[model samples]
Target chain A: MRRSLFPRLGLLLGLLFLWLPVLLLAGYAFSDARIPFQWGGFSWRWFVALAGNERLLAAAWLSLRVAASAATLAVVLGGCIGWVLARQGPFRGRPLFGALAGAPLVLPDVVTGLSLLLFFVLLEGATGWPAERGATTILLAHATIGGAYAAVLVQARLATLERELEEAARDLGAGPATTFATITLPLLAPSLVAGWLLAFTLSLDDVVVASFVSGPAGTTLPMVVFSMLRLGLTPEINALAVVILLLALTSAGGALLLLRGVLGRR
Target chain B: MSRPLLSLRGLSRRFGETVALDRLDLDVPPGEFLALLGGSGSGKSTLLRVIAGFEAPDAGQVLFEGRDLAGVPPHARPLNMMFQSYALFPHLTVAGNVAYGLRREGVARAERHRRVAEALAMVGLEEFGRRLPHRLSGGQRQRVALARVLVKRPRLLLLDEPLGALDAGLRERTGFELRALQRETGAAFIMVTHDQSEALALADRVAVLEQGRLVQLGPPRAVYERPATRFVASFLGGANVLEGRPDGAGGLDCPLLGGTLRPAETLPEGCTACALRPERIALRSGASGPNTASGTIEEVAFRGDDSLLLVRMPGGAVLRVGHAEEDGAPPPRGSTVQLSWEAAAVVPLLG
Candidate 1:
C-alpha cells in the first residue's frame, strides 16, 4: 500500500503541475478585476471588451487563416512523403531521405525560424518572388515545421496498416490510383484528420517561428498577446486566452476521439 | 488436355541470396483445380504471387490465353487471389466489399447490386450484406472474401492458404465449401498450401515442390501411390526409404536392412532407392519369407484405429510398420519380430 501510495501521489502532483496554470487563467477570465491576480467577482465585461478590440480581432483572424492554410498544406505534403517512405521498398539514399524528412521534427524552432528567414531573404534577392515576407512567408514556414509532425503520424499509421489490403484491392481489378483512393485513403482518413488538427494547433500559437517570418502585416494573435504581456496582465487578455484554450481543447478532443474509433475498430 | 488457360515457362525468381523459384514450368488447364504443395521456403506462395503479377520472374514467360504477360500489372490481369488473412476491408459493408470489383469494372449500379446479392447468396451470406467485416465471424468473413473475388468472375483464381486461419473443425467444413464453390464457378484455381492432406483431398492434381523445384506433379492417387522422387515419397506419407544396389543375383543388396530381397518389379537401370509404406508391412514372429527381415520391436504407439510399431534391425536402421488394432494385439516392445511385405509394395525411388 505504501509503495503504491508514492506513485499515486506523484501522478497527482504531475497533473497538478500541468493543469494549475490553465485552471487559474480560466478562473481569472470571468473576473471583472482591473488586476489579473485579484478576483473582483465574476463578470462578462472583459469578454465584451475583447470583442471590441479591433487590432486583437484582426490579429486573431489572420492567425486562424494562416493556421488553416498551413495545416492543409502540411497534410498534403507530409502524407505523400509518408506514403513513399512506407510503401516503396529499398531505394538509393533511402536512409538519408528518411532522416531529412524527419529532420524538422527535432530541429530547434529558433534554428528553423532563422534558417527559413535566411532562405526567404536569399530567394527574394534571387527571383524577387515572395517580394515581401508576410502571411505567405509565415504560412510556408509553419507548413515546413508542421509537415514533419504530420509525416511521423502518417508513417506510424501506415505501419500498422496491412499491406495485403492494398494487394487485394489491386487483385480485385483496382489500379494503383484507384486502390489508393478506395482502400488506402479511406483507411488513412482518421490519421490525416488528426494530423491536420495537430498541425493547426502548432501553427496557431507558434510565436518563435512566426516572429521571424511575420512582417507588420502578418502580426498574429500570439504576437499581440506576447506584446500585451509587457504591459502587465489584464482581464481582457485572460478572456482571450480562455477562448483560445477552448478552441484548442475542442480540436484536441476531436482528434483523440477519431484516433480511438480507428483503434477500437481494428 | 485442352489449350492451357495459363502457361508458365522457365519461371525463376531469386531474392538476393535465396532462390525462391527455379526453372519452374507449369500449365493450368481450364477449370482444373491444382494445389501447389510444399513446406515453408519451398516457393509455393512465390509461384502464386508471380502468376498473379505481384512478383516479376527473374527469367521466363507467363502466358495467359497465349498472351505474354511481361509488363502487365496485377489489376490489369484477368485473375484474382483470396489472401490467407482474407484481407477484408474493415470499413466496407459485406455487400460493398463484394461489389468493389464490379465497381472497378464499371458495371452499372443496378447490375452491380444484383451480382453482389447473387454472390452473397452463393456464399450463404445474403443476410449479412449491410454488416461491416468486423461484425462477422471468422468463417463468415472468409465467405465474404470469397464472394469478393468470385464476383469478378475471372478465368483463374489464386488462393493463398485459404483455410489457414480456421480451426480444425472449421477448416474441414470450409474446405468442402471452397471445393464446391470452385466446381460451381467452373474457374480454374491454383491454391498454395503447406498441409499435405488439404492439398491431396481438395486438389484434383497436386504439384509437390522441394528446394524451389517441382519434384512431382500428377493426379492425387498417382502422386501418393507412385511418388517419383525420394523427397516426394518421404514428404507425402512418411514412407520408409531403403537405399541399395542390384546384387547381380536377381535381388537387391540393401546395406541398411542387412538383407538381400526380391522385389516384384524388375529394377530399372540406376535405380538405387525404394520406398515402403509403413501400413504395407506386416508383423510376425519366428517366420521366414522371400521378402522378410528380422528385427527387435523398439516401441509401439497406440493410435485410435491403428498402432505403429518401430522395429530396430541389427544393422541399426529403424523401420516403421503400422497395423490395425483389430488385426490383433500389438507385439510387445523389446520382442524379436519378423517384418514382411508383398514384393509389389516396394516402390522404387528415382532419386
Candidate 2:
C-alpha cells in the first residue's frame, strides 16, 4: 500500500522553516546568559524582570484598549453591513460597495495604514473633530482594517444561513425586525464571536497602522517590540513577545475550535 | 352568503415581459380546501404567492374578508404560507418553531408554550418538540412547519406544493393528514400543485390553470367527468381523443372513427375530440358492438394494480386500455383486439 507520507513530511518541514526562529526566541527568553544562542541554564529571571517592565506593560495595555475598541466598533458596524448585504438584493453600486468593504484585505497593510493616516490628517484639517491623533486615531485606523475581516466573516456565515428558516419565522407572524432579532441574531452569534476575536487579534498585532496614527497616548504592543528592537534585545522584551504570542495563539485557536464546533453540528 | 374568507378579483402580476398572473379572479369560501392545479409556469404558484402577500399584483385587489390587502407585507397578511421546502428554522427546536408565531403575536409566554405544545400534539410531534429541524425526517419537518403555521391561527392558509419534498408513500399519507387537519381547523386552505392526483385527492374543488389563465374550475368529480376544454381533459387524466362528426349516415356514421360507433354525448358543434379515459374501455376481438373499434395491442404493461394495453388503431392512432390485473393479463403484444366503451363513458371535451 502506498502511504504517500511525503506531503505530510513536507508540510511539517515548511512549518518548521517558518516558525523555528519564533520557537528559538521563546526558548532563549528563559536562558540566563549574555548570548541567547549559547546553551545556558533555564531560569525565570527574564520573566520576573518583565513583571517590573512598566513601559512594555503600558504598550501592551494600550494594545488591549485599542484592540477592544476597534473590535467592538468593527463587529457592530460590519455586522449591520453584512446583514444588509445578505438580506437585501444587490442595489445600484452594490459592486462598488462590496469592493470598498473588502479593499483593505487585498491592499498592503503599510498602504492601508498610510492612507488611513493621510485621510485622518485631511479630515482633521477640514472638520477638526479629532483635533489630535492618539489612541482613538490608532483605533480608528485598526478598525478600518479589522472591519473588512469582520464583514467578510459575517457575510460568509450569513450566506450559509438557510433562507427558508427566516421565511418560516415571518410566516409565523414575526415582523421583519422581530424575525431578525429572534431568529437571525441567535443563529449568527457564533460567527459574531469568531469575527470579534479575529478583529481584536488583528488590531492587537498591528504595528504599521499604530505607528502611522499613534501620537502621544497610544503605543501598541508591536510598536513597543519594534522600538525596543531598535535598542538592544533585552530578555524582558523576549518574555513580553513570548507572552503576547501565546495570547494571540490562544485567542485564534479558541475561535477556530468554536467555529468548527458550530459548523459540525447539524 | 358566508362571506368568502379570501377573494382575488382580476389579480394580475407582470415581471417585465413575462405575465405571471393574468387577470385571475377567485373567491375561496371559509374552510374550503381548494387546489390550484397546473403545470410549471401555469400561474398557480403566482396566484398563491399573491394571496399570501409575498408578491403584490401590478393590478387587481386581494380582499380578505372584504378588506383590501394593499401595502400589507407577508408578515401582516393574516395568512401563512407552508413553503414547499417546509422552511423550518434549523436553529430553533420544534417547540421554538411552533411558538415563534405565538410569540410574534404577543401572546403570553405561558400561553405561547401551551399553544406550542397543543400544536405539536396536533401534528403528533409533542414528544419531539426539543429536536431541531435538520435532526428530524422530512415528514416530521413538514409537520413542524404545519404546526408553526397553525399556531398563528391565520384566517387563510396557503400551501405551495406542501408535499412536493416527500417520498411517494409519505406524500400519500401526509396528503390525507393535511386534508383532515384543514377540516378540523376550518380555515380557508389554498394549495398550488402540479401533481394531478394530489389535486384530486386533497382539493374539495380543483382549478386547472394554463398559460396564466384558469382553464377549468370545479369539484373533483365534475372536473374529471366534465372537462371544460381539451387542455383540462388531457391534463387531468390519460385519454384517447377521437375526432369525428355526427353525419347521420344510415344510423349516424362517423368518418374519422372508421365505423359509426354510436355517438357518445351530443357530439360538439363541429368535429369533436372525444375523450375516453383508459379505464372506461373494454377490450375484445372478432365481434363488433355499437361502440367497438378494432385495433392491435402494441404494448402490454403490468402495473401492480392493473394491466395497461396500448392499442394501435387502423389509422395509426393509439389508445391505452387499463384493465384490472386480477381480470387476467392484457392481450399479449401483437394480438388484434376490438376496443369498446359505453356511450355515456365517452366524454366530449372540445372541437
CA RMSD of each candidate after superposition: 2.8, 3.5
Evaluated at residue A221, the lDDT of candidate 1 is 88
> Could you tell me which residue pairs clash in candidate 2?
none
Which candidate should be chosen as best, given TM-score against the real structure? 1
Model 2 TM-score on a 0 to 1 scale: 0.89
Q: Where is model 2 more than 4 Å wrong at Cα?
A: A1-25, A34-39, A249-266, B241-263, B270-272, B286-292
Q: Candidate 1's residue-wise lDDT over B1-351, tens digit each? A: 589999999999999999999999999999999999999999999998999889999999999989999899999999999999999988888898999999999999999999999999999999999888988899999999999999999889999999898889999999999999999999999999999899999999999988789989999989998888898988888888888888876567787787656668887778888888899988866657556898888999998899998989877789988989889898799998888888888888887
The residue ranges of model 1 lying beyond 4 angstroms of the native Cα positions read A1-20, A252-266
- lDDT (Cα) of model 2: 0.82
Most accurate candidate by lDDT: 1
DockQ by candidate, in order: 0.56, 0.52
lDDT of 2 by residue, A1-266 (tens): 98899999999999999999999889988988755465479988889988988888888898898899999999897897787777678699888888899898899888988888889899999999678888999888877787888888889999998887777677777788888888888789887887788888889888887888878777888887888678766787777778988988887788778776654443
